[model samples]
Target: MNNIRNWLMGILAGLATVFLTVGGVRYVMAGGEPGEVEKAKQAFKSAGIGYGLAALAPLVVTILRGIVGV
Candidate 1:
């Protein structure tokens, strides 16, 4: 149970890291192009969502455990 939780946490953290890195690169390379800037903003939003999910994973798992009696 704990192993699974730890694995999920790691995956979510990795997703956030990847999105953040991509967003940063895009932003730097956008060079004031509005379209590119919008895309970069989307990547940043995705990164934020991933981070939020990672932060909530433990709490969510605990809730599931309670409901499922795991």
Candidate 2:
């Protein structure tokens, strides 16, 4: 059961990573005008930062949970 749960979590994480990466790339590609491109570029940068924060969130949560014995 634990292994199955782990597998599901891993799959979800992988999919999230793929979705964010592809979405960022697609936004950059679909930038139509100069202003739109700039907006997309900024969004891509923010998404990258968000991705980093999201990657940290689980680790942090796990650590806290372990510490709290939750």
Candidate 3:
């Protein structure tokens, strides 16, 4: 059970990271000159992915804690 919980946490954390990073990159790129808007968008996407991961970390931690009965 503990092992399963750990695996699930890892997967969830990874997903969150990817999403937040992508979103961030897109958001950042959304700025800048209109011509470079595309490039900026890409960066913002990454940034978003990072943010998502950060948000997910807490949830993952909580689940892990529960699994360990802590």
Q: Which one wins on lDDT?
A: 1
- The segments of candidate 1 whose C-alpha lies over 4 angstroms from its true place after superposition are none
Q: Mind giving the per-residue lDDT tens digits that candidate 3 earns over 30-66?
A: 6665645655565556556655665566676678688
* Residue 19 lDDT (model 3): 57
List clash counts for every candidate, in order. 0, 0, 28
- Report the C-alpha lDDT of model 1 over 1-70, residue by residue, as the tens digit: 6787788889998999999999999999999999999999999999999989988889888998999998
> Which residue pairs show backbone clashes in model 1?
none
Write one digit per residue (lDDT tens) for candidate 2, span 1-70.
3454455456556666665676567666774766656666665666566556555666666776679786
Best-fitting candidate, scored by TM-score: 1
User: Global lDDT of each model?
Assistant: 0.91, 0.62, 0.61
Candidate 2 C-alpha RMSD relative to the actual structure: 4.7
53 Cα displacement, candidate 2 (Å):
17
Question: After superposition, which runs of candidate 2 have C-alpha atoms over 4 Å from their true positions?
Answer: 33-70
Worst 10 residues of 3 by lDDT: 35-44
In candidate 3, stretches whose alpha carbon ends up further than 4 angstroms from where it belongs are 32-70
